[model samples]
Structures are given as structure tokens and as C-alpha cells.
Target chain A: MNAKIRALISEFGRLSVDVATLKNEADLYTAGLTSFASVQLMLGIEDAFDIEFPERMLNRRSFASIAAIEQAVSELLAEAGRDAEAA
Target chain B: MQTQEDYLAGLLEHGLLFSTGVDGLFGRSALFEATVDGLNALVTKHGDGFNAESVTYPPSMSRVDFEKSGYLKSFPGLAGSIHSFAGDDRAHRDLLADLEAKRDWSGRQKITDVVLTPAACYPLYPLAASRGQMPKEGLCFSLCSWCFRHEPSRDPARMQAFRQREYVRMGTAEQVVAFRASCIERGEAIVQLLELPYHLDVANDPFFGRAGKMMANNQRDQKLKFEMLIPITSDEHPTACLSFNYHQDHFGLAWGIKTADGEVAHTACVGFGMERITLALFRHHGFELANWPAGVRQALAL
Candidate 1:
């Protein structure tokens, strides 16, 4: 999940620094991830993980760091799995 | 002690503003216009030091450029698009009949190629981009325009059609940030000269919808915008009469503007709310300009 998130950040985050060198808790906005780029990253993450970010998850903190992104994706995937089971 | 309604009524009673039957729309009397002009001149006096190129735009801008600016994404509610009658005689007859019958005749109106200028600086970005790369020193512009927003309210300061006097800077991030800092100082100085009690605070645009909440939070987190507030209608809820914004390459990326060193340029602007400040002046210094403070009168040259 970390590697895939890093790959997505590399492709869409438009950060000034290398994603591989950064810590999971590194602030993406400080690394030059603009609001516009963050939206693109959100779209890329949704496409790659095959999960949609709910309206509640659409905020700065949710995309503030790699760890946060990973957590959000994990929770969304778990929520999707539970829905499938209920069906 | 006066409420917004009281202040608005005072303005009307004093012949400062004439009623136009619309809440946010009012015709300024000669005295009101003179005060507004004085405030505009004061802005120019402070901004002249920047040596900015002067540019003036019409009240409306190209719809295509407005869309590219992404204004709709954040402020769809505030945008105003121009529309006109484009149908044939038959449709015109129907429209007149609909209007005569008090039915909705607006459906016959077709959207035009222009939208009302959301901000004085909205048209400047693309023009600056068309001129090619920014100089190492960046570019600066002094602008004033009658801008529009759809919001209507009883607060006279929040006019639907209002003038914004602005100074825009574009270049490297350092250059733009420095420019913004200088404008902040200048903004404080101008208000002090006018002898109006004011405060500056971090602020955000009134972005529309649920998604906008996050966007507003992000903007505040990044400290991208600030406003200078002054008591107009009341002390508790002062009006934002001046604004400082740092766009952080948003305009550069959207307009394909670049710096001399081959990096995307950053942009910043400081806007003076002309009508709001004028209202503040009248509210604080009394309706009669002759009784205003000597220093304030000196600063405004009124």
C-alpha cells in the first residue's frame, strides 16, 4: 500500500521532492503539493484503489501525509468489503 | 449603536444613496461618489510606489477565461453570467407576452460570451501570460474595476456591483510573497491614515457547497488569504474593506505564465473594497465630511 501510494504521489502529487526519500509522515503541502495537485492526486488514488473518497474524507488532513492517505484508503476498502458482504 | 438597517436607512435619509428597489443595488449620490473617489485616490497614492503598470477592465470578462480561472468550482453561487435576447420576432413576441402576463420571461434569454468580472484582477492573468515569461523582477499591475457578485444583502457594504482597487504581482514565489508583505504594511498604513479602527485577520472566500468547506479549510491552513476589517454597520461584525491574497502559482499554472528562470510564476494581490471603506468613513467620521478629523481629511484630500 505504501509503495502504491508513493507511486501515485509521484505521478499526480506534483511534489517538489522525491516521494521515495520522504517519510510517511512528511507533509505533502510543504513539499509543494498544491490544492489543485491534491485534487488530481485524490482522483488518481480513487482510480488506483478502486474506491471512492466519501465527502467526509475530502479534506486537507486526509491528504496531508502519506500515512493519512494510506489510512483513508484502507478504511474505504474495508467499508466497501462490508457493503459487498451485506449484499 | 446603529444596526445595518439603521446605517443603510441613514445613508438613504442623508441622500448618500438612492434606492434602486433592489437590496444590493443603489445609486450613489454626488456626495457618496465624491467620498468613494477620495478613497480610490488614497489607494492610488499608496500603490504608486510599486511602479505597477495600470490596467482597467470592463465590468464583464470573457466566459471562456472565467471558466478556465476555475471560479465556478469554488464560487458558482456568486458568479453572474450575462444573458440577452437572441430569438426571432416570434420568440420576442412571446417574451413580451410572458413579461406582460408576469410569467417567467427569462427562459427566452440566451447566455452571452461574457460573465461579470468576479474580481478586478480576473482578466489580468491571461493578459500577462500572453506577454510571455515574467521578468526576473516580476510584473506588477495597478487595477480598478466595477466587479460583480450575485449575493444580495441589506448591508450596504456588500453591494452586488462594487469597485475593487487592486495591485497584482507575478513572478517567483519569493518575489510575490515579498510583494504581498509590502502590501500588508501599506494596507495598515492607509487605514491608519484614514483614522479608522481596524484589524487584520486570516480569511477565506465564501466557497460554495460541502466540498467548499474542505477547500476553505485548506485555504486557511495554507494562510493564502487575509482581510482588513473595519466597523461599518456594527462593531461586532466589521466589514472586510481590504484583502491580501497569495495564489501560489495557481494562476501561473492555469494561464501558462512562467518566470524568466523557466519556473512557473506565483501571483499575489491586495484589493481595496472602495465602497466598504467609504461607508466606514461615513459611519465613523459622521455623515458630514466637514466634521471629519483633520488628519483623515488631509490623507483623503477631501
Candidate 2:
């Protein structure tokens, strides 16, 4: 999941620096992930993960760092799995 | 203690502004026009040392260019598109009949190629880009235009159609950032010269929707925008009479504007709301231009 997120970010984040050198907790915005690029990253993440980010999570903090993105995606994926089993 | 309505009514009573039946639309009296003119001249005098290329645009802009600006994506609620009656004789008759019956005649109208100019500097980017790469010294532009936003309010300061005087700079990030910094100082000086109490603070555009919240937050975190606020309508919610923005290559990337150093040129702009500043002067000094303070009168040369 971490590798996938980093790959997606590298492809769509348009960061100023290389994503491989940055830690999971490193700030993506500081790496030059612009507002427009963040939107693109969100879309890319949604497609890659096959999960929708709730409107409530659509904020700066949700995408502030790679670690933050990983956590949010994990929680969302677990929520989706639980909902599917309930159905 | 006067209420907001009372202040607006006082302006109408004093013949400074005339009601046009619409909330935000009003006819400016000669006194109001003179004050706005004087304020514009004052802005020009302050910017006289920049050697900026001066340009004036009408109230409308090319719809194609406006679309390219992506303004709708961020401020869909505030954009205004021009529409015209593009119809044949039969359609015209139908439209007149609809109007006579007070029905929906807008169905016959068609959208035109022009959209209302939202900001004075919006049209400058593409124009600059078309002129080829920026010089090493960069480019600075002085512009004044009747800008439009769809916000209709009775605040008198938030007019739907208003004039803006702006200075825009384009070049490297360092050049653009320095220009914005200089603008902040100049903005402060202008407000001080007018003798109006003001506070300069970091600000953001009213971007739309949930995603826009992130955008606004990101803008503030980056310290890309600032405004000079004055107590025009009220003390609690002071009006933003002056704005300073650093685009940081946003326009350059979108418009293909390149610098002499072979990188995307960054951009910055400082804008003055002509009507809002004039209204602030009236509110602070007095409704009567003749009775204004000596320094204020001298600065405006009234």
C-alpha cells in the first residue's frame, strides 16, 4: 500500500523533489504538491484504491503527508470491507 | 449610532450614490465619481516609479480566455457571462410577447463570446504570454478596469460592478515575491495617506466547495495572498480595500508564459477596489467632500 501510494504520488503529485528520498511523514506540500496537483492526486488515489474519499475528509490534513494518506486509505478500505461483509 | 442601512441611506440622501432599484447596482453622483477619480490618480502617483505598462480594459472579456482562466472552477458562484438576443424576426416577436406577458424571455437569449471581467489582471497573463518570454528584468503592468462579480449586496461596498486599479508583475519567483512585498508596503502607505485606520492581514479568495476549502487553506499556509482591511461598512467586518497576491507560476504554467531564464514565469498583483476606497474615505472623513480633513483633501486634491 505504501509503495503504491508513493508511486501514485510520484506519477501525479508534480512535486519539486523526488518522492523516493522523502519519508512517509514528510510533507507533500513542502515537496511542491500544489492545490491542483493535490486534486489530481486525490483522483489518482481513488482510482488506484477503488475507494471514494468522503467529503468530510477532503481537506489539507487528509493529504498533508504520505503517512497521513496511508492511514486515511487504510481506514477507508477497512470501512469498505466491513460494509461489504454486512451486506 | 447609525446602522448599516442608515449609512447606505445617508449616502443616497447626500446625493453621493443614487439607487438603481437593484441592491448592488447604483448610479454614482458627480462627487462620488470625482472622489474615485482622485483615488485612482493617487494610486497612479504611488506606482509612478515602477514604469509599469499601462492598460485599460472594458467591463467584459473574451469568454474563451475566461474559460481558460479556470475562474469558474474556483468561483462558479461569482462569474457572470454575457447573453444577447441572437434570434430571427419570429424569435424576436416571441420574445416581445413573452416580455409583454412578463414571462421567461431569457430563453430566446443566447450566450455571447464575452464574460464579465472578474479581475483587472486576469486578462493580462495570456496577453503577456503571447508577447513571448519575459525579459530578465521581468514585466510590470498598471491596469484599471470595471470588474464584475455576481455578488449583489446592500453593503454599498460590495457592488456587483466596480472599478479596480491594479499593478501586475511577472518574472521569476523571486521577482514576483519581491513585487508582492513591495505592494504590501505601498498598500499600507496609500491607506495611511488617506488617513483611514486599517489592518494588513493574510487573506484568501473565497474559493467554492469542499475541495475549495483545501485550496483556501493551502493558499493561507503558503502566505500567497494578503489584504488591507478598513472599517467601511462596520468595524467587526472591515472591508478589504486593497489586495496583494503572488501567483507563483500558476498563471505562467497555465498560460505558457516563460521567463528569460527558461523557466515558467511567476506572477503577482496588487489591486485597489476604487469604489470601496472611495466609500471608505466618505465613511471615515464625512459624507460631504467639502468638509473633509485638510490632509485628506490635499492628498486627493479635492
lDDT of 1 by residue, B230-267 (tens): 98987888899999999998999999999999888999
Chain B TM-score for all candidates, comma-separated: 0.98, 0.98
> Candidate 1: which pairs clash?
none
* Stretches of candidate 2 exceeding 4 Å from the true structure: A3-32, A43-61, A75-87
Computed on alpha carbons, the lDDT of every model, listed in order, comes to 0.90, 0.89
Query: How much lDDT does candidate 1 score?
Result: 0.90
For candidate 1, the chain B TM-score comes to 0.98
Worst 10 residues of 1 chain B by lDDT: B208-217
State the displacement of the C-alpha of residue B166, model 1, in Å, after optimal TM-score superposition.
0.1
- DockQ of model 2 vs. true complex: 0.41
- Give the least accurate 10-residue stretch of model 1 chain A, judged by summed lDDT: A78-87
What is the C-alpha lDDT profile of model 2 across B1-302, one tens digit per residue?
35578889999999999999998898999989988988989999999878899987888899999999889888999999999998899999999999999999887999999999999998898899999987899999999999999998888989999999999999999988988898888888888989999998898899988657767877887888999999887888899999999988789988999999879899999999999999899999999877788998888888
